[model samples]
Target: MPEYPTALGASSRDSITLLGKDLATDVMGEVGFGELAFWLATQRRPTPGETRVFEAVLAALADHGFTPTAIVTRLTYLSAPDSVQGALAAGLLGGGSRFLGVTEDCGRFLHEVLVEREPPAGDDGWDELALEVVTAERAAGRFIPGLGHHVHKDGDPRTPRLFQIAREEGLVGPHLSLFAAIGRVHPRVLGKTLPLNGAGVCGAALADLGLPLELLRGFALLARTAGLIGQLAEELRHPVGNDIFLSVDLNNRSVPPSAQGGPHG
Candidate 1:
């Protein structure tokens, strides 16, 4: 017989247990989902500040209009209207290095910076360390993750607001500070206006919140799931995926119908 490793579990027939606690009596209504998420991930309850930071990060990344994930979700639904779970899974499947996966990349980068830096001596020390990290990354031909965006050219509007909330909660730390310092030196180092992006801030903030680097990106996945659900709901009402397909077909009408594929059933 094979043994299964498990920490999170549930027992059927009467009541359920999660993290060794009674689910219905100890958790179901007593704590908010954000707090529950923390407990589930860490196997311990979060402090008030930790909960606030976790929830804020989740809320901040929850959605962005017409993102690829949302588009894929809608298209999947068009192909199979009856499977809501399938549509949501299709959207989530788009998460990777180019998209939501960048959360993990950014988090790991910041973690590396923190690991390499000496204990802070003064304000100048942090700036010097941040500059060094940026310079090395640039020299290696690494396009720094979480620093630039295709849209929001001037700057990511979410960055400042997230920092502000972190400040209020006293959750700001070396990772967040170093990320911002790097942004200050960005124009000088890169000779371009690569502003700090939301994912960068999220990575830094989650680092400061003491989340493991491996789990940092999971927070983003969870947030985007909620956003995809909302998008799927709206998609059902407005129904644009078929129209988009038609538009593409109409524009490419010059191609021989034979090359487009056989007739659909």
Candidate 2:
């Protein structure tokens, strides 16, 4: 028999047993989620605040009505009653890319305002900045990331609440003030309100928290997992999850073969 490396081998066995117990108990308190994830997978702990960052990020991304992702959750529940996890996984597969980089972008925007010490005079200054940014981005042929929303013609309901929370929690500082500036600016520019949507607020919050840009999307996913789970549970109680989304597919997909004269099946 070949000799096993007792030193490292013993440590590996210890890690496995510890992780197994931790998993069974859901004992995430002592070790942060980021550290726990890393330790279980690679026997290394996450640095610091990685877990808190993970938590805030997850909470922020938890739900936003029935986007494609939420729709998939409902559909999977309708099709497979017992497979809640499966439904959630399916929904997550469709989670939008828009949510991923939100925190980073918000942070950058706030950072710009902070570094520049440029405080807008009420809403008008805000509008001018928005116009300048929009015009520049459009002229440059780049898509504007967050401005107007589809469902929220005037403003997003989610953004203001988040800002309020940030202010109450004393988390709002430089970035938050900038977000306030953005909110005030919305009504002046497009002659319509542009309440800070979830993505934009999340951006500011993440920046304030000092989390890196790369983690925002992952945070969104973790946050949304809660929504997926809730949606799955809700879907279980009634047949309400039964709405055919073929139309959604139709709208999102490529134009159908030059509108070929008739409804060819």
Candidate 3:
């Protein structure tokens, strides 16, 4: 016989233990889902400040108003009302580069840059470093993760609020400092100012909180899970999926198969 060692959760005939505490008594009503999530990821309890910041990240990502993820979720549900999990999974699967994956991309990008150098002494130093980074990225023709927002061209509302919250909590680490500096200095290199989008800011904040860089997107998905459920709830009440499908189905024009190749071909 072989045994697997574990510290997360265990059940014995009459009792359940999680993170070495009574699951029913210590974890049920006493622990919040946000704090628990952080704890589960780090295997250590988070401070009140950490919990606040982490929960804010979750809230920031929870919904974005008819994003493709929400649309796919609703459409999937309409196609198969019997599989709620399928609908949710469909939405989560859509979390890639242009959507929730920005959280992870921004965090990892910032971390990679920070690890290559020492921490800056102040905003001026950070700004200088940011400028050099932006210039190099521009020269390389690479997009800066978390640089812009399609909807909030002027600014991302969530970006500043999260920065304020992190500042108040004294949890603004190097990742966020660098991200803010980038916001200030990128315009000089790119020749245009772009809002630091919410997903990108969430990535910076999560990195500052010392969350795993790889799992950053997982957190985004976690937040969007709530949004997908809300989308489904609204879908049940308002029922727009069929209309959306019909709109495209009815409006699309059919052309010869040769057109698929290209106009010149």
Candidate 4:
């Protein structure tokens, strides 16, 4: 007989194990969802500071008004009308390198820098290392993940606040310090100051807390699931998916011959 071993869970007569811990007595309702997520992903309990930072990250990413994911979910819901799970999955499916999934890349980038390079001695040392890293990324034609934003040109409001909270909780570490240093040198290196995006900030913080890089995107996905649910609820109240569908459909309709490019070349 062949058997597979599992550390995450197994059902029993009277209890269940999750990540090698008692699910009913140790976890159920006793911890916040964010805390539980961290535990399940890493198989270790989070510290008070880690828990606070994780919760903050989840709250920060839970919504972003009419983002592509929300729009896609609404449109999918309009088409299917009854498949809420499908709509949610449709939205999540769009998460990739440029979108919500960038958090994982950002975390991995920071982890590589922190793990492979010697810790910079002070501000100057950190800045120098940041410059080296940024320059190499640019040379490789890579946009630094977790830096810059489409709308928040000057800075991402959420990032500084998150950093402040982390500092207050004494959760600051080399990963975070290096991110700050990167921001400082970014303008000189890239000809524009790239403020830390919210996801990037969370990535650095999570990396500092010793979380696996693979879990970074999962956190973003979980947080955005809440945001998507809110979007769906609003969509139910104020229906606009039909309008969107109609607008797109109308735009794509074939133009009459007279209306095609001023009627003549």
lDDT top scorer: 3
Once model 4 is optimally superposed onto the true structure by TM-score, how far is the C-alpha of residue 29 displaced, in angstroms?
Answer: 2.4
Output the better candidate (1/3) by TM-score.
Answer: 3
TM-score per prediction, in order, is 0.90, 0.62, 0.97, 0.90
Model 2 lDDT tens row, 1-265:
9976421122344343354444334444566665564344344454454344434445667887767787778888778868877888898777554654555566665666567657566555665665665455556775434455667766777677666666556666556555666566545445555546667677777666655555545556767788888877766675456545555555685666655667773
Candidate 1 lDDT, tens digit per residue, 1-265?
A: 9978666877879988888888889878888999989888888889898898888889888889788898899889888989989999999899888788777888888888778556566567777887888889989999888989889899889899989988888878888888888888767788887878887789888888778889887889999999998898788788788887778877874555675478762
lDDT for 110 in candidate 1 is 81
User: Which digits, one per residue and each the tens of the lDDT, describe model 3 over residues 42-150?
Assistant: 8999999999999999999999989999999999999999999999999999999999999999999999999979999999999999999999999999999999999
**Clash number for each model:** 0, 2, 0, 0
Candidate 1: count the clashes: 0
Query: In candidate 1, where is summed lDDT lowest over 10 consecutive residues?
Result: 252-261
Q: Cα deviation in Å at residue 93, candidate 1?
A: 1.2
Off by over 4 Å in 4: 253-265
lDDT of each: 0.85, 0.61, 0.96, 0.86
Worst 10 residues of 3 by lDDT: 255-264
Q: lDDT tens digits, residues 191-225, model 4? A: 97777898888888888888878778888889999
lDDT of 4 at 144: 86
What's model 4's overall lDDT?
0.86
Candidate 2's TM-score reads: 0.62
List candidate 3 stretches off by more than 4 Å: 259-265
